[model samples]
Each structure stands twice: as structure tokens, then as C-alpha cells.
Target: MSLQDWTEAELGIHGRVLPVMQAPDAVLSAASSPVDPADPETVRLAADLVATMRVSPGCVGLAASQVGVARHVFAVDVSGHPKARTVHGTFVLCNAVVEEATRNEKGREGCMSVPDLTGDVKRASRIAVRGRLPGSGEEVVVETDAFEARALQHEVDHCDGYLFLDRVAGAHAVYARQTYL
Candidate 1:
């Protein structure tokens, strides 16, 4: 299927996400991102996100803001974890927020932006998320594991103009693909 003629569509090359957001400034928000489980636009975006996820081997998720749209939206495919792979998920969330960050820990992380280089960053192990599901128009709260939780937190940061690198507390711990960072 030909991709939608989205007015704000953009691409992330390598691991570097386009329009990477910064720290604290866009960390959080109260905006209610809405979705019409029946809306064509929502479905289109979800399909588009899936297609992107499949073709882009490195992209576990992508947020709308990374494409220059401020709307609260993101897609995640959590097959990377062996536990999640048995029956993993490719899902969407709109205007999602972490109601609480449980189990704070510093873990090494990377991004679709700031490709090649990764740093140890602090993240919540569990997040109680509230958002609208694509094509469902239903608002649901998903309490997910650390990996899935981290993925959502990463994308949500983009919507608010924050990037994973900003979450790096101290000097970076271990560096991977330093050429890209």
C-alpha cells in the first residue's frame, strides 16, 4: 500500500530520529491525545507505523513529534525481548502519559535519533500509561514491564521535545556505535 500523503510525514535514518527533542522542556504534558478506533486517519497512521516498523529494522517505535507533528502518537513492536516475542505486540497510543514511574533505575539506552551511540540513562521500570488506542477511540491504562514501559517513555519524550540522551544522568557509561552518537 502506498503510504498516506501525510502533510507532516518524515523519516528517521540509521538510528537517529529526525527532530530529536531535548530534555526537561518537553518532558511531560497533560494534553489528551485522542484517537478514533474507527477513524480512517487513526488506522492509516497505525498501518503506516507498522509498515515503518517492519521495514526499518532498528525502529522499535516512533512518535508523531519525531516527524514534526506535536500530536501524541507512537508505535511500538516489542519483539526484541524474548519474553515478549512469544506473543509480542505492535501497538499505538495517543496523548499518552506516565501517571507514575515505578522502579526507577539507570539502564543503558539508545534512540532512533542519536543513532549508533548509546548511553546509560535512568528510566522507570514500570509505567501506568493512559492513552487512546488507535481505531478504538477507547482510553485504556496499560501497566507494562520495564522494556515496554521504556519504549513508551522514549516516544512520549519526543512529543514533549525531550530525547533519551537528555535523560543520561552522568557521563555516558558504555558507548555503542559511537560513530553515530
Candidate 2:
């Protein structure tokens, strides 16, 4: 099924809100392991990710590593954001990769894991991503632009063991988050 047609409830598992690991945590820097998307544990993890993202304010996406799982799984939902062009509602993907990326633009980004700061990082304004669904393990590709693209790249970077801080041009591009959103 296409990502747009998939729903988290199809997994038949309810997720728990997991504590997001902060920056400097070892798991945040270590690359995640690829998992069998159809595995029972993986499905639960996918649910957990979605639940965690839902509870966190301003969280558009989340990765397993951010929750200290070290697996290549993440959830994203960019609906209602002013910059979101195409939205897929809420979905989780395992072993997601950017199939294509273009139109680089710099934007301010924040993370639940890196709560202390936000950074100005350049990211693709348009992208195509490929990955597997959590329960069915079915492969799907998503093409999107604007903020959703940026959110996808950010979560993929997290699964790859990189944070938005790592993408910043330099210290000058980083700033202390003045207020929590």
C-alpha cells in the first residue's frame, strides 16, 4: 500500500510514549541497526515512536535512536505546518532512505532529543523517500516538498546517528532555544 493509505492502527499495537534521549547520549551518535519491519518487536517499536511523537509538542518526526533503540525506524507527520506542502498524515517507516533530494534551502530545525538548541541547516526542499511499513513490511516511496521533506531528512539523519547540530554550517548557525514551543 502507498504510505498515504497506511495507518498506524493497522499495526494492531498501541505504543507507549518513550523518553527521548538527549544529545551527547551514546545511542544518539551510534548508527542504528536495520530491522525486519514485520517483526513483532519492530511493530511495537514503530507504535512507540508514533505515540512519543504525538505527545511531544512541535515534534514533526522521531527516530528510534532518539528513543535509544538504535534501529533504523522512525515516524513522521507534518500536517498543519505552514510550510508543509504535501502531507501523509502520520506514518512510520523502517530502514528509510532518501531516494532523491534537491532544492537545498536553509531552515531552522529543532529536535525533541536536542531540546537545548535549534540550528540553521540546509536541507532539500524536495525529496523522494523509500522504506517499509511497520506491520506489513511493504515497501513504499513518498515524494514531498517543503517542511515535510526537511522533517524526513532530519529523522533519517537521526537514524544514521546524526543530529541537526551535525548538519549546521558552524557554531554561528546554532542558537540556544530561547523558548520551548
Candidate 3:
């Protein structure tokens, strides 16, 4: 999607989080994009994020940036319960925000672009996210934490040009454990 030239039709996204690095960069702004709820391109992007989530290793979610767009969007599917069916509740969230975030929790995280690094990062314990479902004016809010919270915080950062590597608490906390792929 051409953030500079693409119109509302050619580019499915209004604005994406990532720029040129295959995925979105960390975002700082907390504003949502104006998406036409009924546009097919918008719907397809959301579905693309969801599909990417399923195929990515060590990935529970994906933001628009990861897909090389710079809008305010992402997708997540972690219905596995950490033990059961690891791929269940697939979701596509567009123009998203955290209405209310509380406390702080730290955990290990990795990005598709930052392939060599996976490290511990701090995030909110509980976050209430609000965003419009593609092609629909109806807005939906999801309360998430744990891995979900980590994923939401991580994706939201892409909107403002922030990266998990920046959030690494210390050198000891960050790791280049493996090149699994």
C-alpha cells in the first residue's frame, strides 16, 4: 500500500504501522485510522493479518506494520489456551486503541522483522482495546492481558514507531536465542 499515493481503493489500509521493513515500525501515536467498514480491501487486510498469525512461528499476533503497511491495524489469534488448540480465536482489528491500560507486566517477545532477537519486555497487565471491525461502523472492544496484552502493546507501539528491541529492559533481558526459521 502506497501511503503517499494509493487511494482508498488501491490500498486496503487507511494507514499502517510499519514502513519499509516488511512489517510496521513501532508506533507512538494512539489515534485510529478512518476505515470504511464495508470496503473489501479493508476486510482482506484484516483477514491477511489473521492468516499470518496462524503461520508465523512463536507468533500469537501480527500488526499491520508486519505486513508492510503503515496504518493503525493488526490481527491476533491465540485461542489455544497455551495448551489446547493453539490456534482458535482469530481476530482482525482495525484502527485500534487501548481505552484503559493498567499496571505493568514483563515477558519475552519477538518480531517477524527482528528475526534474530527475542527478549523480555514490559507491558500492561490488562488492556481494554477499542477498534472498528473492517467495513463496519460498529466498534468492538476487547479486554486482554498476558500474551494478549504483550501482543496488543507491541502492535500499538508500531503505530508510533516503537520496537520491542527498544523496550528490552536490559541487555540481560534481551536474547538472541535461536534462528529457528
Tell me each candidate's TM-score: 0.71, 0.96, 0.73
Each prediction's whole-model lDDT (CA): 0.61, 0.91, 0.63
Candidate 2 lDDT over residue span 72-167, tens digit each: 999999988888988998989999999999999999999988888999999999999999998889998989999999999999999998999999
Please give the clash total of every predicted structure, in order.
12, 0, 27
Q: What is the lDDT of candidate 1?
A: 0.61
User: Candidate 3: what lDDT?
Assistant: 0.63
- When 1 and 3 are scored with lDDT, the better candidate is 3
Candidate 3 structure quality by residue, lDDT tens digits, 1-181: 2112212234344433333254233333223454664577666666666556666666666766666655676676656547323232556667777889898977778777677778898788778888766655357877766766767778777655677877887899878868544
Scored by TM-score, the top model is 2
Candidate structures ordered by lDDT, highest first? 2, 3, 1
Please give the distance, in angstroms, between residue 164's alpha carbon in candidate 1 and its true position after superposition: 0.3
Worst 10 residues of 1 by lDDT: 1-10
By lDDT, the better pick of 1 and 2 is 2
Candidate 3 residues lying further than 4 Å off, grouped into runs, are 1-34, 81-88, 179-181
